[model samples]
Target: MNKQDYDIIVMGGGLAGCSSAIQLRSQGQRVLLLEQQRYPVHKLCGEFLSVEVISSFARLGILEAVRKAGAHPITRTYLTTSNGASLESELPGVGLGLSRYQLDLLLFQRAQELGADCLDGTKVNSVSGGLQQGFMVNTSQGNFSSRLVLGCHGKRSTLDLSRPFTGQYNPFVAFKGHYTGIALPGVIELHAFPGGYCGLSQIETGEINLCWIAHEKILNCKNSTLPDPLWQNPVLAARLHSMQCVRKSQHRLSQISFALKGKFDADVCMIGDSAGMITPFCGDGMAMALQSAEMAIPLVTGFLQGNLSERDLKRQYTSIWNREFRTRLQIGRLLHASFINAGIANLGVSLCDTFPALARGFIQATRGRDHGANLATSDI
Candidate 1:
């Protein structure tokens, strides 16, 4: 067998890509990580970090860096409707509210320190070949080849590969901005509106991350600017009154899809949003990204070392990945319906406020936990 230019090529420099690069490089594999954009930039994310990944970050030696970087401790959940009807519940455990600008940069630098060749401002035009015959990757910067590839290129990418879920029209358009002066300490607020819902939580710099997603048709203009209709949501209006935008501009992304994507796409191993996307309301997308990379490192290692064949590697990884995430994605899809309807959200929050125990059910339902598992709860 001829040696490829690199052992593994990780597509995109997001959480999953950088994470797998770090682990695979630590195991002596030659690694290359490509990102279309430069770092130290904000991404369209809720910036909510679940407690489940804390142990993994500690194991990866980045927990102290995260803490020192001023990651905020998130311990409470506040669910609200457009009318100001709301419910408060305790989170299953403590999570961190860290901005992607800080988190992704930290992971990118760590991967570089571990000897992974990290390249930014490189766009992937196409990906071909597979585990059996090695991979050929063409980027705006140059052409490269590797023994394997990890497609952490996010929910949508420049790659034109058609897959099972590609034909669906993705109706979601998302907006994110940073604001200050909102007293959201130790709390994450999920305020439901007509077209979509908004999330507010404090990040490392004590700034609130305001992210919301809605149907593209709801926007009065195509410029992706804030629509006044969004402010009509009473809960958001209250929060807005107490806060001011930290920046003049906001981040926007379109064509967002929550459809379940396979762990293997275009014959390349997939991770993070590439593999599957949980609706943002679940607050588990970031955790799933880190968890998928952790799950893939060993299989990626085995395949590269010739200990596992292509067929066995694909079967094992696909099976395990499906087992872990499929149910969560399905539940997220189901919950999406109830959340978007104004009447349902109004009634749900009002009922939940009256019965805190029932509100815990709503929390547990969206969270990626198995049925019959107990969730920690409290009343406020």
Candidate 2:
């Protein structure tokens, strides 16, 4: 038998890619991780972790490391509508506030320490071959072969255009920045405006992460920056006025789509946003990234060991992926759609205020089951 270059080659070294590399390596599989950018970088994200991920972090052995890096614990949520109506509720569980810059670096180092071959600053130009034939990955660093490949390159990549699962063009744009002088250490806030919403939370560095997403039309109407109506809400306005923007930490992205994404294509398993991006309002994208990595490990392991056929592996992974995240993404889309309408937005806030249980239920529904126990017991 001809030996392949690696047991697995994971493209895109963000949370999904890094975590997958670590998990696979822990199981004694030789893995290679390709990342186009260097470590400790910022990405456009809400930068909030849901409580559902605590167990996964503990299982991944990064709980302590994350805490040491200054992750702030959050237990409450505050939401406001464009009309200035507000609703507050206690979170079902404790969440964490940490920047991707810190989180990604820590995970990457852990993967390297565990013996996963990591190639930072390397971009994968193309991927070919199939499950039976193995895969030929052409990258800026060099070409390589692997029995299995995982795509975690995230939203809107050049690879997406080349793959069969290219989603429709979405006009949504997102902006994120770190700021100081806004206080609300234990609470996560989401303020809704016309065609957009903003999330503010305290990350480990003591700076507030202010991220907002909106339709391009709404932003274009408002001087092409902060939406004008966002300041109409007193709470959000005050926070915005008080924030001292961190120039170096600002990031932006355009053409974000919330459409359902294809899970498997060209014999590559998609994880994180590469698979499907949950609407940011749910604040579960980071957790979903970690969870998807956990979901991929067992299936990939079974396939590489010959206990599962390529067809079976893809089928089972797609089933598991749909089962785990489909509903949450659906809920996210519904909520996002509703919020885009001013009347529904205000009415929803009023209802949540009148019935706090409903608010709690909405939060619960958005967060899926905790699979930490399964991770703990799994050899991979």
The number of the candidate with the highest TM-score is 2
lDDT of 1 by residue, 12-110 (tens): 999899999989988999999999998887888999887676766876778879878988888889888877687888777778889999999999999
lDDT of 2: 0.85
TM-score of 2: 0.95
In candidate 2, what are the lDDT values of residues 209-238, reduced to their tens digit? 999988877775544446686776677888
Residue pairs with backbone overlap in model 1 = none
- Clashes (N, CA, C under 3 Å) per candidate: 0, 0
* Residue 170 displacement in candidate 1 (angstroms): 1.1
Candidate 1: list runs displaced more than 4 Å. Answer: 221-224, 368-380
Output the number of the lDDT-best candidate: 2
Q: Per-prediction TM-score, please?
A: 0.93, 0.95
